[model samples]
Target: MAVFEGTFAGDVSNLKIAIVIGRFNDLVTDKLISGCQDCLKRHGINIEPNNGQVDYVWVPGSYEIAMVARQLALTGGYNAIICLGAVIRGQTPHFDYVSSEAAKGVAAASFQTGVPVIFGVLTVDTMQQALERAGIKSNLGWNYALNALEMASLMQQIQNTSSSPSAANLPPGNETIALPKVTT
Candidate 1:
């Protein structure tokens, strides 16, 4: 049996990445971006905005992250995309709709584009909890970046392997599945 896996120890310096951030909760999202940048930099990825291997895109809110992410993914320029946002629960049901849509949209973008889109949005019960996760205790943005790295590498491996004659011996499965394109 053959196996393929992605690790953080690979050379990601050449991989282009994009981070789409939601400015709705800058307090938490900003820290998340910091943590994410730290991880990518540690892994040898240049995090300079617009002039390096990574680009940062700011959206009005989490609700808009998906649209922008999908657009970027469609461009076929980025090896992976990381999304950062914070949606704290409020007294009203507004939290539910926004969080759910953001999650779904991020997933849809990845599925449609066959690109790695990391959903780093935080859906916390309170500001304290969001802060704690953002940096107070640990930052999930670091995790999100790590995920993007791993997925990007894995996808690359799969693409390369799939084209080889060895992949033809694998079990039979549908290889022509199509995903719907994202519309306005």
Candidate 2:
């Protein structure tokens, strides 16, 4: 049995997050939005701060999440982006296309911009699965929020490390110093 433990201790108080929600299944997506907000709030995040700590924008559907996320990342304003949506599989092949496209698009956006874009969109075959994953009754938003916070922290760390000069970049073995002789 494989257990998935969420172990992320990151401080995101100084970072900004952009949440792009898709309005496909309003009911399900709404719950996700609530979860995201509640989780963020629990982490000391103010989504609607007048001074701008977090920002939210609603897209038409799941397909648009990537475009919006990409735009936000490219603008270089937010430290991270969370794409939240619910695409319950339908009777047609359209389900596969939307779900896969959304996933790929989000991935592409994150890779291209070098920003952490979390994939909070739920692609389930049934409404029950979506609900279960969302932790509507079990309060699973905690997990999602943790994911966002951790990813944001990771990105920040990478950015900081890359910009700073490290010992490895210094002249080979130039860090060595002469040792003084002890009392004879």
Candidate 3:
């Protein structure tokens, strides 16, 4: 049997990546950006502001991340996208709405465009938890970057693979089954 999978191992110098950040929670999102940049830089991807291989896009808040991400993905300019934001629970239900919608949007963008969109938003109960996850304890941005790399590599492999083999090339005892034709 043949198996296919993605890994965090690849030459990232030629990969084009984009990061979408929400300014609503800059305090925590900034750290996530830092961790993400560190991971990309370590993998040999240039991290310069504009001319670098990685491009950064800023949105008003997490709620807008999905729209921008979908637009970018539609451009076919980036191999993968990373979205970072923080939506802390508040007295109202605003947190739930924003976080849930952001996640769904990010997912929809990837599904519709066939691009790897990494959702790095943090939905925490408190500022302390957000800070800890952003950088104090660990940085999820780094992991998100790694995911982008692996997914991009895998996508490249999938796209570059040869087309399906013909029935004549099938191994013995594995003949192709013919479907009956129906006339409407």
Candidate 4:
């Protein structure tokens, strides 16, 4: 049997994350939030005393996550934003529109604002799928949380590399240097 262990050694000490959850599927969203919080805490991020490390907000539904996330990213307070929602397929085409719009909107917000906006939304064909993804037994929330943290860390790395004068002035010969392998 293969075994996996959780480890946190990346430079996420000063990163700030904003979680915008959709109340449409409160249960699943809550699980996502819990997982996100656990991951953040494990990474040495402080969320209390107005430390401005982590914050969260609730919106009406999945369709509203993009707008709220965009607004939060525009505030220049958070390094990354995690949008959580669950859209279960219904009998109508409403699910298609909402899911596509939410995904595109979040992507647009990330590109336009230059902030890392993670799409943690679950677009499932059944409630069972959502439940399975949210349940601790399945470890889906843990997976999503890991994704969010990795994305946040990547964004920070990019920002840091872009802002450094030496990096900006890299010689053409060193432009394609390979990145070190990631152990975990």
Q: Which model is ahead, 2 or 3, in terms of lDDT?
A: 3
Better of 3 and 4 by lDDT: 3
Q: lDDT (CA) for every model shown?
A: 0.89, 0.75, 0.86, 0.76
What does candidate 1's lDDT look like per residue over 100-165, in tens digits? 999999999999899899999999999999999999999999999999999888877777766777
Candidate 3: regions farther than 4 A off: 162-184
TM-score of 2: 0.81
Per-residue lDDT over 28-50 for candidate 2, one digit per residue giving the tens place of the 0 to 100 score: 87787778888888777886747
- Please say which candidate is ahead in lDDT: 1 or 3: 1
Instruction: Name every residue pair that clashes in candidate 2.
Output: none
Which 10-residue span in candidate 3 carries the lowest summed lDDT? 175-184
Off by over 4 Å in 1: 169-184
Ranking by TM-score: 1, 3, 2, 4
What clash pairs does model 4 have? Answer: none
Give the CA lDDT, 0 to 100, for residue 58 in model 1.
98
Better of 1 and 2 by lDDT: 1
lDDT of 3 by residue, 86-126 (tens): 99999999998999999999999988888889999999999
- State the TM-score for model 4: 0.80
Of models 3 and 4, which has the larger TM-score?
A: 3
Better of 1 and 4 by lDDT: 1
Candidate 2 runs further than 4 Å off: 1-11, 49-51, 137-141, 167-184
Point out the higher-scoring one by TM-score: 1 or 2: 1
